[model samples]
Target: MSPAFNLETCARPNILALEPYRCARDDYKDDGSNVLLDANENAYGPPLADAVSLTSAAADAGLDLLGLHRYPDPHQGDLKEQLCALRNTHAHTAQTLTPANLFVGVGSDEAVDALLRCFCVPGRDRILVCPPTYGMYGVSAQVNDVGLVKVPLTPAPEFGIDVPAVLAALDAAVAAPDYDVKVVYLCSPGNPTGAALRKDDIAAVLGHATFNGIVVVDEAYVDFVADQRTASLAEWVLEWPNLVVMQTLSKAFGMAGIRLGAAFCAAPVARLLNALKAPYNIASPTSTLARSVLGPAGLAAMQANRAKLVAQRERLIEALPQIPGVGRLRGGTDSNFLLYEMLNSSGEPDNAVALAVYTKLAEQRGVVVRFRGKEHGCLGCLRITVGTEDEVSRFLEALAKTLAEVRQ
Candidate 1:
């Protein structure tokens, strides 16, 4: 029989079919500093940096030491406590959604694996992915032994969410006798494509998944969204209990090196994800640095960087059409990247030609950009991230030269 909840109905019976991972309070709790015998850390590792150096050093000096002598917090208490303030959730009565409702991983990548491990059963469960989106979703699902259902977005429709197709897929899953759909994943300000799913579209998916399954909204690029319109289904997790909002500090915060991302969901979902994560997922230095970046001053600087990137993105879009062989510019409603197609004399789509142009600019002109072909629904396109004014100018110069050479 199909389960009562849509998420459960879509999951592997043996997986969502079972209780979530649970750890004893004492098991997760921290007990002072010395004699860390909990998770079997290396007896000796890198030495810790001085407090003074850690506090006011330049970026290079700040990241100098590892000090992996002791295992960092498994539950990530201090980091979560700090992020709670930054996220600014509603007031709680008994216990304001503690660190338990939060799971910090090496990056959003680990969190993706943890979530799949928690719910997916090998060879029985499947995940649905929208094309021209982040590839990690499909990759993680496959690595975890879960099936993948491809639902390509209609490029003709501005690559908007295929509401009807998604709804039909849900209907089909519900009709199946034994199949269970656990989670539906969506990426906003989606990668490569840079298309931001609308609020209404996200709400529709959330509402549909609420009764039967879980909806995971990946807001990895939310920080780059113009006007900050990216969905915050984080709070919805409190009310709906079936929503999981994942975010990363890699992009806007310029903390990609620190490698930290978070998953915000109801306490139950968070607990399950937390339990499935590695005991010591975060490093001591990473936790400390993440905390520092989430502070008021650091956050302001991050926002300023985002604004600069957006401006650069606009400039690129405006300039692309003027260049011959470039058909039309796409993407960048939200996010720092933009995509545009380059056509050959025959009017045929040729991403390889575009990639060659990209390489020439990078190798000969010293300008680097991402080359994302039409494989994931982005035919004959180039994905370029916004850089500084000087960098953008250099890119335009390099691009013009490459186009002239390609024409010849």
Candidate 2:
């Protein structure tokens, strides 16, 4: 009946997009631009600059670590501007993602929860997930007291979403009296499965006629994917208003401890999230470190590290299947991790062996891998994260020994 889908129409009515609480530090964003007496910060600066140890990058950024007395910028204008430029470098068919298209948070988890709170009314609205994916999506749903509908991804080795099943679930939920599906969470280069979803498949969901809820694509490991500038769906925010692309610095920027993440979406959706978040969700140190690492040198460093990881990943892929008890690799070659099944006496996947292999390696040898044999279609599989050259070599030796010990 209407011309097109509107995000507001699908969102919870009570959850209005109110203006964010303005902070005194916000006005003094430009360094040495104003007197800055409004926030009542100590003009004396920190007494113990000696207590801090600055990294080369941080020192190069020339941030005022002494300015810890003042609150952080609620708008995060500068950081968002840099991130927008990074994303815009990949824009071709889609328009540029400005500061308006971004929402920064404490890891991607905050954005996930924010999306749930902004749209779904707890107990009345539900969300959908393609299983054998990230567990945080379900954790966030439960935390918000919202319901979930799970449509498992395809069988082992491909873990792609069942598009028909997803649409069918949405259509069925619509006819029900009390169930309204509000959001869909998908992991690209999926967590344990490690496969990137085909672009066309995502397009199909975005173009769905009956389902109006937004779709979120978590690209936590996007930096590890080949040709990331082309593979990322971040630029899709301009083309698909109902789409949200989540990314993080933890995986590639080597800043997991920093706990910073970003969500790129339609400018309106982004503004809505900004309005809903706390007055100052990001801390001064976090923003400073983020700015330091988002520059040209940081990107080059990350890419060089990525190249090492990719080479190690290929090393594992070629060698893992050759082991006596190891079966074929189960997922695509996109992520920093790989999933492979352990073989039983008859050469079929065997959970007992997989668990034994996982236990023996971690306990006796200090090698740790996730035992994901129970996840859908991941029978007897163990997920291994790509580590440093020495770590990978050590893991390979340890894994072969563990498998031999377990099989015996």
Candidate 3:
């Protein structure tokens, strides 16, 4: 006879002790939704004209329009092919990438989760992260029952990864008898920090002989980075088998609703992730829309939108410093957002003041931005996304009013 499963006893201990990730929407749910500058989603929606053109082309190409009833392609070959073409155009590499090198997921979050599941065994395995970075890496680790080793970024060097610290941490973990560090998560054009980790620094981590683990670089905002050279390190996957580059259509392509993310890695790792993920995770409509957006016309529209957003980002960088009580804008201006401190009467980062501004802006002024004071090294900081010109103006005006009112 087969043994009966006890739900409580069978549940993993680490997962049992996990605190779930608090999404932005969860905190600010239905307080009369206004300017959604939180969550770092692109304010601009997807390229409708391009989508229309592509859909028409797709119909003409005899694609099954009623395929919504069916499951999405398990491999998502068409989307992967388009992604490969896109990557090849931007950064040419001698080694060609096939659909075999790609793994498509519902979003980058899924990729993150899948990567952990594929590589790290529950409770015993560990992952390294540079904090004041993406929250999801830690959250995913917790959910998967994987130990997280944090080597915090040096606050001085614009939140760059501390290579030596990372090495030491990895070595220490390796020397320990129980835990095995299986994955290292690096967020390029980092979430709240907006800093791109140097390629050389990343290469050093990848080359670390002692820590034989997969290095997952989350380039969720790579397209927003002005410098193309520093923006993407996907091509490096060809050279480093242990490297995995994750990107999303949500940020740059303005397809958050569609929920498509790409993972570029060596074939074996890709296969493992594919094996671990739900067979029909990416829905048919989502795949269809994703493929349409990844088409040539859609790519052109995305580029145009990117150019506009970058211009808007530059404008914000120029204007934000002039606002009263706004202090140092920390981190590199590589992504669409800016991380700056809110100073109090003493010109120091005042958590209370920052919280007041954040609350007042959302509650009273109908403008929303992230309050990241609790993050490592991000004292009294607000991470604001680069919105439309009008939105930016509104935010600035709202900020000025909120600061004055709070001070009064």
Candidate 4:
């Protein structure tokens, strides 16, 4: 059994103890009943669009001109309500999420940084990251002026977390002289790997009796998983106060530009994040677009889109290995992306050929795939995002051509 977790003790003594800046929006509801002079917003609404009436198409897609002059709902109560409702449908827990359980940020990056800053004292404390995972976690660690503890995922085929090594590291630092691990950042359907971590492995880390740190599980591409309800650990947050599950509309909803991401955790943690963030971090337009996408109609649209990508991703998995220079499809096919290797003459992974294929595909054929040959255990690999049928077809064709040329 794990030791009892305490947010008060885990947080940086001085930094995380915060009193939130209550804005105008926080004082009163904007329920169209009382409008007024509080937040310094312009009384005159934003200038009307030139000669363009609100079209049926705009209304149908839930697109609109937001009140640009006024500040966005700082609490974002409505958007959080929609998000909680959506996650609750897939959640296995009886504990339903409320607005208090979520902290909306500009992107998942903001949450990552906030977690690091609130918990980790720069230069003295650190965060743990499994490499061949998201780059942003490490980037955020550095940007926060905190140190990083790296325990790479067990090599390719599985690319699973090395829980033993992680526990050992955490245990070793428990009574260390300096620099304790304050957070553990995990990526499910891992950024480049496209691999989902096993639930038990994560649970082991969370249940570590000696380690008293936040375990952040980034489920950014969770929707792309074949069975997201089973794959997501979102519901686990209800049971584990130290857990924070991050999700975004960027992957499945196809709304990356909206710059909205959420951290679903216990209420106290959520409160800490809310207090720590900018007063108006999520813009009105961003909030509007997010609400539209997360609504019932937009959700249906997203499901339809996700179905198409899953089909295409499966097709690539089957067909990609047939090419002369292509090797095994690395990791799990748990995301809208695939990580596969480029083969050399002797049929081993080849970084030179992989780089060439990546460069030629973008420069000559107008297809783009990420080259991540330098990452640990990812030799001669390209991370290809699953695109539309035509786009995937073009990528496969372009890849085959490029590989043949590079090999020769």
Candidate 1 residue-wise lDDT, 1-408, digit = tens: 112454444444454445534334345564545565655556565444456465346346444344456656566778898766655445222234556668888888887777777776678766777787787888899887888777776673267778878877877776776655567788877777677777677666666732376778888887776555223445556655677778888988899998999988778677667656666678878887898888888888888887888888888878877877776666655777788777776666588778888788788888888777755666778888888989888888888779778756
Q: Which stretches of candidate 4 lie over 4 Å from their true place?
A: 1-4, 31-35, 48-66, 89-91
lDDT of 4 by residue, 1-408 (tens): 347467878988765667888866676767877867887877876665552465334546555553467777778999999988888854557777888899999888788888888899888998999998888888888888898889999988899989999999898778788878889998997988888998889989999998888999999999988776676777668888899999987888898988999999988889888888888999877888899888888899999999999999889998998899999888788899999999988899999989999999999999989999999889999999999999998999999999999988
Between candidates 3 and 4, the TM-score winner: 4
The superposed Cα distance between candidate 3 and the true structure at residue 382, in angstroms, equals 0.2
In model 2, how many backbone clashes occur? Answer: 0
lDDT tens digits, residue span 1-408, model 2: 112357778877766646667765555465767777786778787675665666334565776667777777788889999888887855444577889899999999899999999998887889999989888889999988899999999887889989899878878876778888889998998988889998888887777787878899999988877877776888888888899999999997889998899999989888889889997789988998898789888888888998999999999998898889999899988889999999987898999999999999999999999999998888999999999999999999999898888888
How many pairs of residues collide in each model? 15, 0, 0, 0
- Candidate 2 residues lying further than 4 Å off, grouped into runs, are 1-4, 25-37, 40-47, 50-63, 89-94
Residue pairs in candidate 2 whose N, alpha carbon or C atoms collide under 3 angstroms? none
Ranking by lDDT: 4, 2, 3, 1
Q: How many angstroms is residue 123 displaced in model 4 relative to the true structure, after the best TM-score fit?
A: 1.2
**lDDT for residue 103 in candidate 2, whole number 0-100:** 96
**Which candidate comes out best when scored by lDDT?**
4
Of the candidates shown, which would achieve the greatest TM-score relative to the real structure? 4
Candidate 1 versus the native: TM-score? 0.85
lDDT for every model? 0.71, 0.86, 0.80, 0.86
User: For model 1, where is the 10-residue window of minimal lDDT?
Assistant: 88-97
Runs in model 1 deviating more than 4 A are 1-67, 89-98, 209-211, 229-231, 346-349
